[model samples]
Target chain A: MLEIKNLSARIGDKEILRGVTLSVPDGEIHAIMGPNGAGKSTLSYVLSGRDGYEVTGGEAIYNGQDILALTPEARAAAGIFLAFQYPVELPGVGNANFMRTALNAVKRARGEAELDAVAFLKLARAALKKLSMQDDMLKRNVNVGFSGGEKKRNEVLQMALLQPGLAILDETDSGLDIDALKIVAEGVNALRSETFSALVITHYQRLLDYIVPDKVHVLAAGKIVRSGGPELALELEARGYAGLEAA
Target chain B: MTALPTQRLESWRYTDLRALNAMSFAEAPAASLPDGLPDIGVPRLVFVNGRFDEAASSALPFARNFAAVDEVSDLPLARINAEHAHDGVTLEIPDGVDAGVVLLVSYANGGALHPRHRVSLGAGAALTLLEVVKGDGVYWHNPVTDIVLAQGASLAHYRLQDESQEAFHLATIRATVAADAAYESFTAVMGAKLSRAEFHVELTGAKAHTHLNAAQLLGGSQHGDFTSVVRHKAPDCSSRQTVKSVLCDSARGVFQGRIEVERVAQKTDGYQMSQALLLSPTAEMDIKPELQIYADDVKCSHGATIGALDEEQVFYLRSRGIPEDTARSMLIRAFLTEALEPVTHEGAHALFEAAIETWWARK
Candidate 1:
């Protein structure tokens, strides 16, 4: 569903994602495991269309369209969702209102009818239930004052509501405890379908235990050095990235 | 004499309307509110051109308020004159009267230059005062309000200032809170060619408290300033001030807040914060928040910040299918949301938010 062909990106004068190429087909979960400053987040951002990241070379296509040509919102409407490494805390914007706006924006792009307040609440409640989050979260500001686990779950809650075709989760498990990780992974796992795909960018194999990926890729420096089955994640966990980088 | 520009006057330099002196305003004829306002509230005093109009003023059942002095003939108008004193309204909450009051001040084009209002909250009295200032045409409006809080009195004041693009609006509010009194003021400014508001609060008695919050949203070449001073003069007094502004296009905004704690005001606590968001490259903001503490036992702190819209937040929203413009507008609205939170009246808060949305829409 998503394809990155020799995608290269840079931040100011420094090149990060140097001609990195990868593809994740529908109905499968892919993992990109890399150490810090290894351009793992850079790949996610480049695919999601973040500012200050210049794509010096190559192309990224989603659903047969050049993703680079579309604005971040357009990409999202085209079914691209990026769960930020650190979710923003919008102090006054209610979570429900935010989800409704985003859902409607995507629907509008797809020529679908917008959901009214009643319909939105009904759908949102079901999604929140899947994430095991309380209804109070809807009334509260978007992620404001939420614990790290809560913010991560909020991101998944948004993903569940948006129902995007492809989701790029960048370090969503970083601050999550084991139990919280299970719930988050369960939320993502439940969304897995014949038409849904995801790029799970993480450093630990613990998250892989929850939402097992169909394939694992080792991203070192600016390129993917190796690709293997979910068992590769175990191998990398047993033998740290330091050993693999020198291999 | 030209007003002292001590970061006080020409602070409007970037978007100065002082050149507006060349334009003349025609006086509005005797007029009253046309319709659709509830009359069940407490007493109200309506004035035009710093003069009271008894015939048009409303005196409801629960309404038992009006200056015992009838006219504030001896009130200070040192810097105000007939040349600038166009029209005004005043309301006084009598002793022991604990009710709510609403004052609607509407001005038309060619109206007077200055409209003044004076309000006094009697001891043991509590009141929620809603003041709405609106204008129709391109004119100059200078408004000044003076408030006095007696011992044990409390006031919840909401000031809505929305004028026209062609109008130059300037206003000042000076309030004094006596011992044990409390003052809570929220001012929202969303319109006008050149608008500036000065808020000065004096905590004069032990245990007195003052809270000031302001939100200003300006678009086009509109200009606005929210300058405030909170002085704690008595021991154990407390004060807090927060101001937020959003500017778009070539618009400009300024926030200068100062909190002072006197030496005698031991155990005093003062805090102030000013934040501004520039939505456009040409948009500019000046924020200066200061704290002067003379009491070694007092706690005082002040902070100011001016920044452009958060590009990261914008991208995050856009990546979710919200257009860039919509994302930026949402962030701007969020930036000012904190300052508007203290407004407990849902309807009033909605009206102010609507004003912000309209400003963004017009942009």
Candidate 2:
């Protein structure tokens, strides 16, 4: 489970997330729908402990522990995963090697035995298959030349491998085609379980059609203006947030 | 060993090796020579004090076509300051002989340790050369290496510079590549108080390929300079140069890479990139990548970046549960991976990686 309490964040001198609060329980998928500059990505970044973003107020708690004080890798070790809106390209670093290092780092933090090269390769191959990704992707540099959809799927692949307690997908549906979206959604759907939770950050309800969120929170400006059942996504998609200012 | 030459010496123009003469470099510890060296050897020629040590070196049996020398009487020494100019070793590969891993080890220490090595691969031959340079005690090391690759030959050379911090080091590597030949060189400098390395490559033949990569990690008051010049005299050759420098504390680093292409060398492709990461605010670095291309049809590009650590990446790793120091080390390790790629020997790669990690721990 993850909790955000009055999380206020800013970049430079401008405020981004102003008194935003949300929570996602185990086995639940929460959707945050907002227009451009709604602080959607900023929320994900702040949660993942990115630098240069000032957290002026409140805190984020994950799995009964304060996460705001943790480093990014610490948050990751604590089972907080963020599928970046844009996957960074690490040249000369093999994709599988990076994934394995990340997995082992988290695993070691959780008191789990580290996986060797063979075992890591097997697990990575299985995860790639589940995500409908090719095995050749394992040999290339991390996201060096990956397609946009491939990068999104790779993010899911990492999430599945790390088996994070809370996974945040930041605009993962942006560049995915219909098939790729379906595959990505299937990857997420397959990872759904009683102990898993996710925050799906997106602008449209198209992805919701496949993943099917249990709760939808409309985030405007910085705060979550409305929280409702799955039907909230459809309502927002039809009516748009143009009228939400008065609400 | 002789005393340091006066400042009037032309060779010591930019730097004064005499500054180290005042400090009494303690006697060098006895070395129990390498035990059971691997037979995975190629054509090897060893040098000590900038001169060939024949008794300590071995040559291939019935060496006919290839030219192997145990001594060179006429030394064309360049940097002769004072009366102490030492001799060096030289080796030449005959045409049409493809040699495997050629390991050249140079040991320098005490007083003035100057060694010179000359390597020439004949036409259509392929060779791999590795130069390992290190020493103990406070000493001065000034080693020079010359390599000539004839037409259609390929050469790969790697240098590992690990000297004592109390030592002053100066090394120059000059290479010439002929038509259709390929030359690759990599240098990793990890120690020394004032270590300066110069790399010069002259591409004299058409369709020759040249690549150079260097990584210099400096801490304490260590000073490292990787100055290089690559010339494209003929057309259709490709060249790539990348230098990465990491400086900590009061350490100083410099990267001056110049690439030149003559007007006749059309269709030349040359690229150069240099990046410096300063861990401490007091750490200093000077990176200058120059391109002087006379050929209008050549594609020449260069870039230099100097900055502190990437806070975003650092935080990303830290938030992943890695400690602050560990995160910085990981990023630095990743940054160095690019320079270490040319090392084909996995064991050597691991050794270099461990050295980098050890240096990071000291930071």
Candidate 3:
């Protein structure tokens, strides 16, 4: 469902994601493991069309359509979701209002009937229950005063609500504890289907144990150095990135 | 209205009232009036060019002829109201009575108008007051309101000043709260070419509370000023003042707020904040928030912020699929919510909320 070829990007004078390429077919989850500054987050930002990320070269395609040419919002309407590594704090904007507006916007773009306040609240409450979040969370400002784990879970909540065709998880497991990791993994695991696909980006193999990936790609020096089955993650865990770099 | 204070004057330095000297004024004939008052069975008092029209007003028990001039009148406009204001209203709420609502409407019919209103609430009384000022054509609207809240009494006042585009509006209010009394007021300004609203509030007795909240939205060449002085004179009294201004195009706004805690006013808590959002590069705002505390055991703070739209917040909303314009509007509306939240009347809140949206949409 998603493909990238010769993807190269940079910020200002420094180059990141130099000639990186990978593909995640429909119904499959691909894991990208890299050390700090391995252009992992840059890849997510580029896919989501974040500003200041100059796309030097390469092409990213989603569902046989060019994803690089669309605006961030348009990409969202086309079923592309990016769970930001650090969710921004939106003061005075309620979480429930944000989600409902987002859901309605995407629905309108897809030519579907939009949900009113009553229907929207019902759907949101059910989603919150599934995610083990309290109902009062909807009343608070978006991500303000939320714990690190709660922020990640909120992102997962958004993914569940948006139900995008392709989701880019950018370091979502970094700050989460063990329980939070499982809840996040369960939330993603629950969405496993023939049509749903995700790119699990992380530096450790611990997350792989929970949301076992169909494919593993070791990203180093801004490129995919190796691609293998799930066992590849375990091998990398035994030998750190430094050991692999030496070899 | 013609004299502009030079920069040497502290309070009126940036606001040049003399700019209004060039506009010609005319006597606005009594014409059709708009539905400016809310429908809450509020006894209505209508004034045209400072004269009460018996045909257009419904009498309340306190409606009476103007008394002699007040010795406290300081400015030329206040003195003008004291000398010329006719058919003024004096609303007195009896002890322990819940006087529902009282509506005061002042229309500057293309000429100089001075409408004086006095409101007094007896012990244990409660009331909600709506005061609206508007007019058509070139006119001068000078209104003075004095309020006294007795012990344990409470009052909620909503002031909507939306004069015509060619109109000049200057309003002054003085209020005093007795022991354990509560005074709350919210003002929303959307009209007038040159307008100034001044408030002087005093917490006179122990355990008193006062809150003054305002939101001013303007575009074009319009100018607005919200100046207020709040004094905490009694022990354990608290005061809060919040002002939000949105200026677009070449519009200019000003906020001058002074909070004072006297020596005997121990345990006083006072807060003042003024924030302005400039939508255009040329749009300007001048804010001066001051705190004077002679009391040793008191807590008082003041803050002022002048900024444009937060780009990160804008992008955050845009990424959620809300259009760029819609996202900006939402953020602007949210910014005004803090000032509007303290407004107690349901009808008045909805009305002013709609006016804010309409102002932004009009831009």
Candidate 4:
């Protein structure tokens, strides 16, 4: 389970996340739907411990540990993953090498045996097949010349391989098309288990139709204004985020 | 001998030799060969201090005796090299002969050492020369190499300058390519407290080509300089230069590349790029790219980029569970991929890669 209590953070002088409180239990996927400038991305960045964000007053506890004090890599090793909205382009880093290195690092931190080249390739090939991605995807540099949809799918690919317990997807469906969206959704669905929980942050309700969430919250102006069952997302989509900040 | 060039000269602006001039170096004493020398399974010539070691070298027909260097040049370093250089390689390849590989190893313990090497390839000849320079303690290594390639000849020169942290290495390389000839070279600068490798290449005939690529990995207080001048004097000639530097601690890196196209050198294709990655707040890089084109129809371009590692890229890697140090290394190796792409020789590539790995580990 992941617990975020009174999560107030800022960038420089402007406060972004102001007294935000939310929780996602085990075996559940929650959707955080919000309008523009609602501090959705800031929430994900703060949870992952990215630089430049100052967490003024809050404690993010994941599986009984105060993860707000951990480094980004430490949080990742503690089973926290944040799917970036914009995947970084690594010009000369091969995708296979990157994934293998990341996987081995996580494994090493968890006291698990690190995978060799052969074993890692076998696992990667299997992952690619399941995602319907071609083998050449592994041979190219990491997102060097990838298309918009391809970059999103690559993020899902990383999510599938890493298998984090709590994934915070920050606007991953923005630039993705329908076909790529299904592939990404399937990648998340395949990892559904009792120990797996996800915080899917998106603006449109179309993605929620595929991977239905157990709870939906409206985050407006850095605070959760309304919370309800999965139908809350469809209601907000129909009524629009207008006047919700006043609620 | 001419005096050492000072910072007042435009070409020596970034690299200062006052420290070297202040130190008084005695003649290098004969020292035993160091253990754990790289054996690339080829014909090798070993030089300890400033003297050639015949016992440790393989006997080859083309490996002739060291001849006196009588060539005079305006460069002070070259003039100094010609004056004091006693023993060096004189390799001469016959026409159409493929001299597979030759390894030249230079090891210095201390003091001043200068070795002048000369190589000439006949028409349609091919040769791959790998030179490794290393030393210990404080010393001065100033070597000059002269290469001549006849018509249709090709020479691939690879150098690894792994000197000691307290050593000074200054090398000058001059090459002349005839019609249909190619001179390709790559150097990795991973050692030495202060080092500079200056290259002068001239394409004197039609269709002659050259590629001068290098990578400098410096840490601590080390300073590395790679300066090159490619002169295209004939039509249809081409030259390419890609230099990359990774600086850490208070290290400094410099790249000075100049491309000159003569009036008759129409259709000349020249390109140069210099990039640097500064890993610390104190590390510095200087890049100067110049193009002097007298030809009416020619293509010449140069680019340079110097900056710290991208924080967004670092965060992306760290968010994926890669440790900070490993993430930085991965990005740095990526930065060097383009500069190292031209090193096709398998053994030499591996050796350079190992040297880069060692430099990273020490940093």
Task: Tell me, per candidate, how large a share of the native contacts it keeps.
Answer: 0.71, 0.45, 0.42, 0.85
DockQ, candidate 4, vs. native dimer: 0.89
- For candidate 1, what is the DockQ-based docking class? medium
Model 4 per-residue lDDT tens digits across residues B1-363: 568999999999999999988665446888999888878999999999989999999997898888888866789899888878888899999999999999999999888988999999999999999999988999999999999999999999999999998999999999999999999999999889999999999999999999999999999999999999999999999999999999999999999999999999999999999999998999999999999999999999999999999999999999999999899989999999988877889998999888888888888
Identify the candidate with maximal TM-score. Answer: 4
Better of 1 and 3 by DockQ: 1
Best model number under DockQ: 4
The full ranking of all candidates by lDDT, starting with the best, is: 4, 3, 1, 2
Model 2: CAPRI class: acceptable
lDDT string, candidate 1, B153-198, tens digits? 9988888787767777777788999999998889988878887787
Q: What is the lDDT of residue B205 in candidate 3?
A: 98
lDDT of 2 by residue, B164-234 (tens): 77788878777899999988878889878888787789999999998889999999988888888899999
lDDT of 2 by residue, A13-66 (tens): 999999999989999999999888889999999999888899999988888899
lDDT of model 4 at position A95:
98
Q: In what order do the candidates fall by TM-score, top score first?
A: 4, 3, 1, 2
Question: TM-scores of the first chain across all predictions?
Answer: 0.98, 0.98, 0.98, 0.99
Q: Rank the candidates by DockQ, best first.
A: 4, 1, 3, 2
Flag the better candidate by TM-score, 3 or 4. 4
lDDT of 4 by residue, A102-206 (tens): 999999999999999999999999999999998899999999899988998899899999999999999889988999999989988898899999999999998
For model 3, how does the per-residue alpha-carbon lDDT over B259-319 read when each residue is reduced to its tens digit? 9999999999999899999999999999988888899999898899999988777766666
Which of candidates 1 and 4 reaches a greater lDDT? 4
